[model samples]
Target: MTDSGAVLPWLVIREDDNGNRYRVGRYATRTEAEQVADRLGARAHERLYVVERVDRATA
Candidate 1:
């Protein structure tokens, strides 16, 4: 769960380089996220992950 208490559908692509995390896109399903991750990971040498994300919002 995120700070906003909402679970997002899917986080498509995430890249971590030098301890910096970058969110690329969000998808409707995990399968879709994984597909994009596979393609991006093949080209990117940095740490990449495709997973679900919880929505976070400042209150």
Candidate 2:
């Protein structure tokens, strides 16, 4: 859970050099999500990792 004690809504997304994007995972805090992205990015420099809040409107 996040500091605010809410459901995890932040999402980690990976975008490849080929222009493909997909969700990696969800975290309660942005910091946690970023850390995961950083680790993934370090292992695969060819792909790009990013963190974003879940868009309930689109869901």
Candidate 3:
């Protein structure tokens, strides 16, 4: 997890019973989802999200 109003990016990772990995979403800014990942730690699969600034129309 990152500090509030952090400009850093974040990733949301989730695993299923079969041990499949998935990325729920990518955020340009740190959010609650990132915090969840931090708390879950190694128990959860890794999903990386990079911080990128894009035009709203293109994004």
Best by lDDT: 2
lDDT of each: 0.68, 0.88, 0.52
lDDT of 3 by residue, 1-59 (tens): 23665443455656665667666655665656566656665454454322233345543
Off by over 4 Å in 3: 1-8, 35-59
Global Cα lDDT for candidate 2? 0.88
Clashing pairs in 2: none
lDDT of 2 by residue, 3-57 (tens): 6666788999999999999999988889999999999999997899999997766
What is the RMSD, in Å, between candidate 1 and the native fold over all Cα? 5.5
Question: In candidate 1, residue 17 scores what lDDT?
Answer: 81
Best prediction by TM-score: 2
lDDT tens digits, residues 1-59, model 1?
A: 44666555678656578666677776666777888888888787778766765455521
For each candidate in turn, the TM-score is 0.63, 0.80, 0.36
Candidate 1 vs candidate 3: the TM-score winner is: 1
